[model samples]
Target: MPDRHVTRSGDDYAEALSQLLPQGQAWPRDEGSTLMRVVRGLSQIWGVVEASASKLLEVESDPRITLDLLPDWERNWGLPDPYYQEPLTIGDRQKALVQRMTIEGAQSREFFIGVAAQIGYTITITEYRPFMVGLDRCGDNRVYGDGTNLMYSDTFVRGWLPVYDPQGNPVALDEISEWPNYGLGPDTNRHYWTVHVGTSRLTWFRCGGGGGQTGVDPHLRIGLATDLECLLNRWKPAHTQIIFDYSGLTNGGSMAGTP
Candidate 1:
């Protein structure tokens, strides 16, 4: 006998479409490959829509009504947060500093578009990058060999950030780390999380009065990590550990230090 494929239901078809197009982007952006992936994903969605139409006609259902099966913020259903902010190229550090400070309390949506218009705009501006990337959590079970809990984060260095002055230049200031899981190193099995939210120069540098600016210091890392641990520990299921990988944006460097 030949193998047979089963048809899918409206809900099942939607789930399949989601798994195929998980996240907003497709991998490996080659021209031909990207086209194929998009076509496949679109076809799957169309199938779901067609099946839904058939079901509606059979039952004479109200098309205006919508059904939400998942939780309010489930990974599959919730809208992914926009990460890009307007990019502004400045002549020097001081002007950058002023522009960076201008976006202090701007909400994510009105920012860069409406608010920026209200205020005079000049310096080069690019949309903000993703605030977070590759945020994940792990679990632990003695018998299951998964006895680990961790959180990790990474951010851009001098990347197009939200803060700016009236002149639209980027400030040389740093971000106060507000990641949920702050501190707890890898060795410990109790609880830990690491967050990277600072800027750095790609190559090495030296100042007459100061020391080298290569490695991350203890004070800043500990402060953020500690706060994260405290926040997670409050829950009944305490988080164990987190590892942040900021190397991608920072050119393999840490920004948690006094410059």
Candidate 2:
């Protein structure tokens, strides 16, 4: 026997179903037969039902594939976090959802490292403590004052999102990029932390930077910003300050499925 016809027109279904009648009804097989016409009409309704059922299973819950459902998903997930005052691109919205679903909160180094891995980053978190003479071991490298590293400015101009490199050089930063943190003022060094994400993704233009390709678009530069600062900031312990270190990127890395 063959597989039953699945999504056919009413006429096809009528023909198949009509055959289920006993052979004694064969005398009514003509087009004028009311019983045959009634079955055909009913099959039209069945055909509509078949068409609906056939397509329903193809629907998806994946945020990227279901663009229209993003608002619903985000709403239910309580997303578009208050930190994101600037409008997000389609790509960012997708990233936000993936981040939300994959993030599991904790204050440990392993927890943050795992969260960063899910969104195309490999990170190492460093916790800080104000250096105390007897409490800290020699060469433990703890700081006495702020121990502040030149990192991304938490204060962005006009509240736009900017990815900060916490371990960046002080010389490279302009006045606007400088974080107005108090130096030699407070003893809250224990609340500060840094994440070294292993190298910058930025590609600056230079005469010999390209591998002999000349026609490449200069404006189409790869950006270093991952918008990761916002995600980490929102989830980090309320008392801790975060610094993203991008000045020490290493070689030979792939971002896909990094966990």
User: Evaluated with TM-score, which candidate comes out highest?
Assistant: 2
Cα-based lDDT at residue 10, candidate 1: 47
Off by over 4 Å in 2: 1-58, 62-68, 80-95, 136-185, 199-221, 250-259
Q: What would the TM-scores of all predictions be?
A: 0.15, 0.50
Best by lDDT: 2
Provide the lowest-lDDT 10-residue window in model 1.
140-149
Clashes of 2: 4
lDDT per residue as tens, model 1, 1-259 = 3223344654455445545644545443343575445655655766776766665544223212212311122233221212212211111112222333343543232342333232221112222222222442332100111222221222323233233322223333332222222223433433333323222222123322122323432222211222222222222123333343233223333222233
What RMSD, rounded to one decimal, does every model reach? Answer: 27.0, 13.3
Q: Tens digit of lDDT per residue, candidate 2, span 1-259? A: 3223357778889998888877775537666699889889888987887766544433225664335566787898888787654444444466678778766688887777777666556676655555444433443221222223433322322232332334423323332222323233357977998887764333323333111124643422344435567678877999989877766776434332121
RMSD of 2: 13.3
